[model samples]
Target: MFGKKEFAMSVHHRSARFLHHHPVAQVLTVFSFWLIGEALVRVLGNPLPGGIVGLGLLLVLLAMRRISTLSMRRGAGWFLSDMLLFFVPAVLAVLDHPELFGLTGLKILFVILASTALVMLATAFTVDRCWKYLGDRKEREHA
Candidate 1:
């Protein structure tokens, strides 16, 4: 019964209201889902890290339309806006390893660069495959 535009507007309106009056609830909801995902990972005894598993769970929820990302967007935005703050501790910890910057530093730097390049290449390939699969699926559906 709901038109797509109307449904989208209603979702937007609900999200705005959530952001305005229940921001804490929104944050808690996100945290709770992540916590549940972490629990699932632990219970399954999977090698994958809890954060990654949690993210996968969140992605599934979003894709299935079981949850609206609008509620989490503001809280995520707030955290990302101050993302540098999260890196401060890691940077400081890296400074603690003065030995890593000596002769072996060049080797370490090479490894870092190589690993970064490989990761980028792998991510690009994965994205390309996923895009092609999605495009093919759409074409088949239309046909």
Candidate 2:
């Protein structure tokens, strides 16, 4: 006969193991957050896209320690690894627009390249600052 404590622990262990083994469930968990964001947007009549809201929500949850990074690691890794696939539709859609091959297209391409460079630079700077801040915090804690 199993004790109550043992039974609860057994259930928790089984659930943790199931989550660890099932990447699909992890992805669904991520998607559920997005759906929640979409519902919130619909209810609040916000102008921002659901995906952006969802990402912000996820970030806040992670920052506040409400969610463990490990819980989202596998799903986020899969999405990041296959991110190029997400842009395939946009690339294909460009073929349907003949004007994009002309001077207007060149201008758009230039803007895209410039914006990408700016975003990369900004991201690099932010990451470097965050790294330094974390390193300093750790050093202070140790001291």
Candidate 3:
């Protein structure tokens, strides 16, 4: 018999409480990871990516509980759900690279195909593990 207000308050309370407790540390930690990601990309002359390292660093924090699931939950969940939208800008670059596509398109296609496969596999594995971990946590909550 819970009303909408109760549901909303509960959600708001969780999000607020998480933000309140570790606001500064969370910001610093994320900033550090992203900075590392940026530095890795620039210093290493990354062909594939740079921001991925920062993401892995954040993943490490999640595993260690330096950041709680609730704290990361909101941002990561939102990002993953709408991540495609974020790629629009990158995709637009293809329009400017029409000549590259026309002349040596096969070479680019091969690289793209391989990289896409790798990325898909990696994302699947990560998402699967996270789902299982969360599922187990829910089961324990009920038990």
**Clashing residue pair totals per candidate (backbone < 3 A):** 0, 0, 0
Residues 1-143, candidate 1, lDDT per residue (tens digit)? 99999999899788667655666776676677678878988899988877778788889988998667776776666666888997888877768788888978788999999999999999999999999999999999999
lDDT of 3 by residue, 9-38 (tens): 788777657664665545554566778888
The segments of candidate 1 whose C-alpha lies over 4 angstroms from its true place after superposition are 1-21, 110-143
Candidates in order, TM-scores: namely 0.56, 0.63, 0.41
lDDT of each: 0.81, 0.88, 0.75
Give the candidates in order of lDDT, highest first.
2, 1, 3
lDDT for predicted candidate 2 compared with the true structure: 0.88
Q: Which stretches of candidate 3 lie over 4 Å from their true place?
A: 1-32, 40-48, 97-143
Residue pair clashes in candidate 2: none
Q: Each candidate: RMSD to true structure? A: 8.1, 5.4, 12.8
What TM-score should be assigned to candidate 2?
0.63
Per-residue lDDT of candidate 2, residues 14-106 (tens digit): 766776778887788788989988998999999999988999999998899866677778988888899999998888887889899999899
Query: What local lDDT does model 1 show for residue 137?
Result: 100
Model 3 accuracy (lDDT, Cα): 0.75
Best-matching candidate per TM-score: 2
